[model samples]
Target: MGADLIVEVALRHDRSEWSRIVPELCGGDAELEALVRALLAHYDRPDSPLPEGPYPVTLGPFTLDRELGAGAHGKVYLARRASLDGFVALKLLRPGPGMSEFVEQVRREAGRARRIPSAHVVPVFDAGRIEGGPFYVEMAVCADPDEESPGSIRIGRSLREAQPGLDPGEAARLVEDLARAVHAAHRTGIVHGDVKPENVLLTPETHRVMLADFGIATSLAVSVAPESAPIGTVAYMAPEQWRDRRAPSPSSDVYTLGGTLYFLLSGVAPHAGREVGADAPPRPLPASVPPRLREIVQRALAPRPEDRPASAAALADELRRFRALEPTWHDRRSVSRRVLLFARRHARELAAVAVVLALLLPLFVAGYRFFAGRVGELAAGEARLHGRIQTLDRSRADLERDVARLEGAAESKQKELARTESRLQQLPRLEQALGAAKEEAARSEAALAQRDAEAREAALRVAALEAQVAAVREALADAQSRERAAREDGATREAVARQDAGRALGERDEARRRLSDAEARLRTLERELRERDAALAVARAAEREALRRAAALAPAPGTK
Candidate 1:
């Protein structure tokens, strides 16, 4: 079975429901059941393949390179427009039946989103449907181009995946930015049906969150039949959306923004791990979240849309208020810090005022004594004046000493200032030298990088040579084994040949001995015959010498 069915099911149903839903749909078909099991094993993997149609090489002026991400209705591609050096995200709706409404809604809402005056919203460049093909939207890629080379494509990581459990202040700031984007859309009568973390993309360098798939989700919600299943992400969908009780509104967007914030603050969705009924209370946020922010999120996640923020703008304002407390209301300095800062700003002026007050205090006392003398206590006034004079003299002496001490300190400070000025004068030369040093370091680093590259090349060559050597060793061992086997065979053959030769030699010796014995027997028989012939001749010589010749003649005649 093809994975298109599995991919469709995965895109449609929640993963938590796959266990029951897959078997129920498969209905005992082993192939689909096994495929579903395999898909479930790694469906959520980033590298999992979604069985989409063959990718188009070029759509209009855009040359498609590779897919960045996929969704229920469409897939986004990292593509290059004609003759452009930069890249843009090209979203193409999967060509199928019953998608014309979605295509129209997307074209309309994306146009509206294009007019939105918010920097946080991903900008749309163009959108149109082919006469007999898929609908397409060209938009600014919500990522830094430098993140991936021109040779490859990368989707910006979602907010939840990139920076889960963010600081409360950071979470608030991000949600506030999202709310502002939503508010911008709301102004144009476009309600973002889905505002989950997956729709929020973060730039690689600045990590600035930008809302993506702005009109796409709303288009999906509008185009999808209400009797089928509710639209939007379940984890962050508003209660009204879950119940299909009403159409998407700015308040529903506010609820999703709150859910996104909750996910950021606690690394989990507002519903926690499980889906909640429309009547059920939302799960509490993590305790570590700031109380004020928790309250803000809770209000945004309210089950009743009417009880939530009046609009996305209102939600943004609440988030702004919570964020303001981070750096303003709760960040106020203590009284002591305020005084210290005030003194630091007016140090010289305060010193002068203190000195003037100290000097005038003596004059004020003297004036009082003089007035008393005029008032008829002349003797007492005179004594008091003398005492006052003495006290004034003592105070004057103390003041003089303090002045002298201060003067010495001031002189030391002046010397220090002179030294600092002398150092300041060397700054230019130091900076020049520093610049030279930095240039030299950069050159050295470049050289080192080159050397490292060469070293890596050499290492790779060495590894290749080592692999060749290993192969050669294996071949040599095989050849050696063959040679050894050949040698053993040769030895066995030689031993057999030697044994055969020995047996042949023994047989020849025995035959030669038997022949000699036969020859001896023949010779013995010949000698015996000769002896008998001689005995017969001796016997006949006496009595039948004359008869021997006649008998021999007669026997010859008879035989003839």
Candidate 2:
């Protein structure tokens, strides 16, 4: 019988009842009976301590609900706090002879976590030893009611479960929060020796991330001797962390954070090596990840501690800037690269500006020409007015001369009349001459009035022309201003386009390099595959030859 079926049957009966029924179930087969008995013995063992099976109903102030997860150190359970209304994670330490150190470690973790007081760090509630049983610690549950528990899901699961992957910005933000928590611990002289995705907790409802499990954390102030083997997950540990056999520092945390980010982005650790080389290139990130972010991750994962960010806080700052699309320290270091990235990011805006400038170009030229034409017309009108003013002045001068001559003639006539008064015969002739001179003076006055009217008309025309000229000049200035602005905008667009082109070229070259590397790897794999195929073919032939020889050596069917 199958072990599962035997166990199922065995559970349904009491020990004495099962012992009598097992032989009948096995049907006198010794092997089957022995197998059933072995399975029964495992099920009936008094000290199995199965995490998913029977357990005490309560531990101190908490009532156990169900098992969340189990590890070598302990089994965590979803439990209701007797004193509180909310659910908490109750981790019950395994019972062992040398478990005092583990219990002390749990207490230390609780104390360290409580002291930090950061939202990103999971809070610890209480720790105590259950009477005649395992040691347990109650901590805040890091999960939502409808979502998978934090212990059930890890970074790899989060990535794999989602189609494609998490959004790059969201992943970066999550890691940034994690780094901030680590930084907070570092500031308090606490190093989270174990920094990996499995130890990071995520709240599904709030999407808030918290760093969990500081069991291996060490304080810099305390002079604890280094262990023979390095602590922390091997995949994320720094090279110096292992080679130097030293306690983890802020830099070690930084490396693991980078590895976490790498896993978030690419769904794999940066490298598999327990102690990666300083010069080893990090696994390439996906094309979706921004180059700046990828570079930041790579730098943080640098094998040498000194080569990485000085602290987790600095790494968090870089990630924050990346998420905000602001210039980072790396971008600030290279002006051309920064400009190129800016141009590429804002290409659409640049294109819109260029279109606007193009559309305004003809309007600007036409407006300029229209204003220039109006100005020329005003200038011509002004010149005509000046000429008319000169002509009016000449006419007025002529009229003044005639008026003076007429006055002179009238005075001469008056003198002649005075002399003629003595002689009665000359009296009629002087009266006629006076009438003629009077008519001549009236004509001269009319001519002067006409000239003055013409001059006044010319002055009015000049004033209107001056006003039109001023208006045209203002319009011309405005058009010139707009044209200059358009030109400047066009120049800027051109510069941006050139920069974008350069960036595109660089990206194409990068793509080609990657393709070449991929091709080289493909060739190597193909070679290995062909070698395996040949070996497989040779082995099959050798087997056939052996079979032929064996058949030939077999005795003739009837002769033996």
Candidate 3:
């Protein structure tokens, strides 16, 4: 009765252990829904029990104990590093359909994680492939991707949930911080190819942005199949990625940052379900955004890669400049606060310039008025000098009378006659001197004419000589060119008759080479023919001897 009852119960109950799981099944999410659908399809089979083993995997210094959670890529394990005596979250590659290469791949991701150098980037502590099996484990001693990151639980369960409620200023700061974090990764030869709110973690107290998941297809050095579709969250993907699936660059992260900010700044995702067509123009920023800030958001989200900021650093510089003039902009959040602080620091220097202008201008105006009053006092002295000069002019008549009395006492007329006679005697000497000057002038004029004639002749000769030299040089160049042609492929040579009438020779060149080659081939053929003749002569002589032997042996043949 026990055996019959057990068989009856097994047949009557559902095979998926569904009766034991009914409560959990009823609360199904997609992950649970997907899992149950898979199990229900195969539960009734009698031949295949659940496949089981150690399912061997290992992290850096620790071995994976057992499954903690089954995920899309593999199962997560709560692993402990034996060396450190610390627990780490490890993702173990499972062996099944299409999982052979996945183990090495997961280990490669973990290898990349160690290379990233930021406090924000999650550290990959250990990675190893299981011996004799296609499985690898990644040991990361960090927060779970499933749990809520700090400073964001106010929005909901995770950073992804909090993104939508972030105000314009907070959103801008977060986006800028993410840009900086991604740029830092790029500086170290890494690229956060996958950038979304979930990959960003904020510190609980400071709200400082932290970029997470450095090894999950986020490094520029990580190569993947271009046709395999970018292995990142779809909503934040740059439009260029959808068209070609090219490896991400700094600008690709820029586009994702813009997308994230767009969602945070406005409650709508820019193109949530649809990407801008590769040929379409970019969508505008939200109307509520300040014009200057909107321009930055639009430029980053441009559909074409060529249209976006060339680098994250370039975009950050542009944002800082724009934020300076944006009166409505909120500087209360993240990195934006630094820009405000910088302006505040320099404000005192600007205020000092203002205060100096106020004091100096009034003093300058008062000094100019005092100088004008002094110039008016000097005007009276000039009029007094003019009156004194007019009085002195009347005394000149008395001075003339004194001069006349002195001339009378000296007998002025006799003195004048004596002086005239002395001057007349020197006239003859002056005439002779004038005649000598005329002769010297005539000689100089004649010499100048002769020099002009000589100069004209010399100029003409120089011109003629230069023309002759140019012609000679042209001839020499042409002759050298022809000489080179004769040495090369030219068969016929035109002799350059030596202008100096010196040595000349005719050399056989291209034509002679052809003749020499032909004669050599003929000689080879003649030698071959002589060898053939000698062989023929020997064969004929042997034939003759064989005939004589045959004749001699004929009589013996008849006797036999």
lDDT per residue for candidate 3 within 1-560, as digits (tens), equals 12222222333456666455533444545554454444344334443222133654454455655454543445556566667654565655433322323334545666665666555565655444444332445554334332455421221122466666566666677677677667777787666777766556565445666665565543212322334656565667787775677767778888877777676766656666654433333356678776556767887888887888878776665666554543222333446665655656668876897799788989988987997887776666666766776666655565556445434422342343344335435534644543454354345334433443444444344344334434533543443353344233211211121111112112224323433443354354335435433543443344333333333322332231
Write the candidate numbers in order of decreasing TM-score: 2, 1, 3
lDDT of 3 at 20: 55
Candidate 1 vs. true structure, TM-score: 0.47
Q: Going through the candidates in order, what is the number of backbone clashes in each?
A: 0, 0, 2
Compared with the true structure, all predictions reach lDDT values of 0.65, 0.64, 0.52
Q: After superposition, how far is residue 256 of candidate 2 from its true place, in Å?
A: 0.9
lDDT, model 2: 0.64
Instruction: List model 1 lDDT by residue over 1-560, tens digit each.
Output: 33335545554677788778777777778887876576456435544343343654766677787787777667788788887877888888654323555666677777888888888888877776543245677888876645447554445767867765468888788888888888888897777788898789877667678998877876766665554566677777787777764666788888889888878877777664435444445677778877667777777777887888888877878777665443222223356544554676678899999999999999999998988778777777789999999999999998777656545544453454354345335535634643564464445434434444334534454344345444544543453454345345434533443343334333444433543443464354345435543543343242232223222223222231
- Report model 3's TM-score to 2 decimal places: 0.43
List the pairs of residues colliding in candidate 3: 191-218, 191-220
Q: Which stretches of candidate 3 lie over 4 Å from their true place?
A: 1-97, 127-158, 218-230, 275-283, 320-560
Cα error of candidate 2 at position 10, Å: 37
> Of 1 and 3, which scores higher on TM-score?
1
- Residue-level lDDT tens digits of model 2 in 239-310: 786677666777888998998888888876665653454425466889988888988998998877888988
